[model samples]
Target: MAETTAETTDVASQYSAQVASDLEQNLKEQERLSAEIEALQAQLAALQHNHSVLTNIQQALGTSAAAAVSAAESVTKVPAPRKKTATKAAASRRTKSQKPATATAKRAGKKTAKASQTQSAAQSAAPKLVELVRAHLSAQSEPRSAAEIAAALEQEQPERGIKTTVVRSTLEALVAKNQAQRTKQGSSVFYTSTDTAEPAADGDQSEQPSA
Candidate 1:
């Protein structure tokens, strides 16, 4: 009976030691699982933060792109106010350009008027050349050649540029008007006045062309 009691006590001590070891191993496994769970939670939180940042950046970019498109559209529209301003500027430039043309035209008109007035004054100042020729023909009692009449008129009025050709043309004109007589002796021609009018004083003739 003493031996059996000793064996029973030894078996109980062995079972107590095995139970303590098993309990210690179970606690270590639970600690390792807790650490792994904490690491996985940290990684998940970091991924969520990155996702939020990326979403915000995308939204900001989208807003900026929309604003840029709006600005482009506004520029392309070409509104009425801009058109009116451009038209007014063009009109102003045209008016400025036309001012010189208008001034030039006015100056040209004044010059033309002055030239006309001067020409009229010159015409009024000069005497009719036909009357001088008639008066010279009436003064002669005998028939005279065109050269002789031209020379006499040139001596009488040195300022008058008398020409023989012009005197011949005037004598022909007087014959055509029935105011003088033309006599042809061989190749030479002579003229005499048919009118019985009195003679004029110092007959002045010119080299003016016959009308």
Candidate 2:
């Protein structure tokens, strides 16, 4: 009977110890679960704060973009002043009204310049008759008559069609200028270069008796 009582007490103590050990293990597990839940809740709070910051940033960016667009539109949509438009119209009308006169002046100036150039070209192309007569008389070795001078001129320059009267008039002009000496022989007037004539003022011994 004593052995049976000892076995019963041993069994009861073992059961109590096992129950206390299980209770301690359960409490440790509960503490671990609570720490895990707290950690998760902290992470959620941080994520919510980050989300709020991002949302605010996004909203600010959207507002700034909208303001920029509005400013650009306002700048592009501004209307020109009425007074400036009127002034531009007046300037356009003035230019239009002056166009005809400006064109006319330009045309007149061109015509005048062309006429002056043509006159200069014509004068340059046609040498003076006095110069031709002097050249002829200077080339002669002996005295020549006006008719002979005219014939020589016609032979040299067939385009001139020079006449004896024109040659006579040019010879008279050269004699008047002391560039030639005139001699009358038997009613026929002859000319010689002044270089061969006796040096005298006006070089005129006109109408010598036939000799």
Candidate 3:
């Protein structure tokens, strides 16, 4: 019975030692697991911070891009200064082009007015010239040629510059109006007032001397 008791005590001591070793190994494993968890947490926190920074950078880039687009759109909406200057230049050129035509039209109008005035003056003087010619012819006792009538008119009125052709035309006009009579002697023509002259035959060719 004493031997059995000693064996039982030895068995109990071995079991207690085995139990202590197992407890110590379990504690070490727990410590190692806790250290691993701390490292993993630190890595996770760093990743989250990096993600936040990246997100902020992306947002800033997006805002900058939007601003750039808006600026470009605004620039496109406004017209360029050069285009305005070109439009002004074209308008100025058109004005300059029109100025010459306006000036030419004014000059043409002035010329036409001057011509009308000259024609009116000539018409007004024609009747007085005819009357002067008729009076000179009536004062003569003999028929006078156009040259003699012109010379006499110039001598009577020094201010008058009577031409032979004008005197001839006036005499012809007077003959047409039955205010004067014309005679042709060879190549010379003579004019006399109708009141003081008699009509001659068609075949008669005679020269009369001036009185």
**Local accuracy of candidate 2 as per-residue lDDT tens digits, 74-182:** 5445455479886677566556655654565556556655765775587578877678889888888789998999899989878756767667766776888899999
Model 1, 97-175: lDDT tens per residue?
Answer: 5565556555655665576577568757866556777888888887789889889888976664666766666777788
Which has the greatest TM-score?
2
Clashes of each: 0, 0, 0
Ten-residue region with minimum lDDT total, candidate 1: 196-205
**Whole-structure CA lDDT of model 1:** 0.68
User: Model 1: residues >4 Å from true position, as ranges?
Assistant: 1-90, 113-129, 140-143, 152-162, 182-190, 196-211
* Candidate 1 lDDT for residue 37: 62
Query: Per-candidate TM vs. native?
Result: 0.36, 0.40, 0.36
Which pairs, if any, clash in model 3?
A: none
Clash total of candidate 2: 0
Q: Write the number of the candidate with greater TM-score, choosing between 1 and 2.
A: 2
Global fold similarity of model 1 (TM-score) = 0.36
lDDT of each: 0.68, 0.72, 0.72
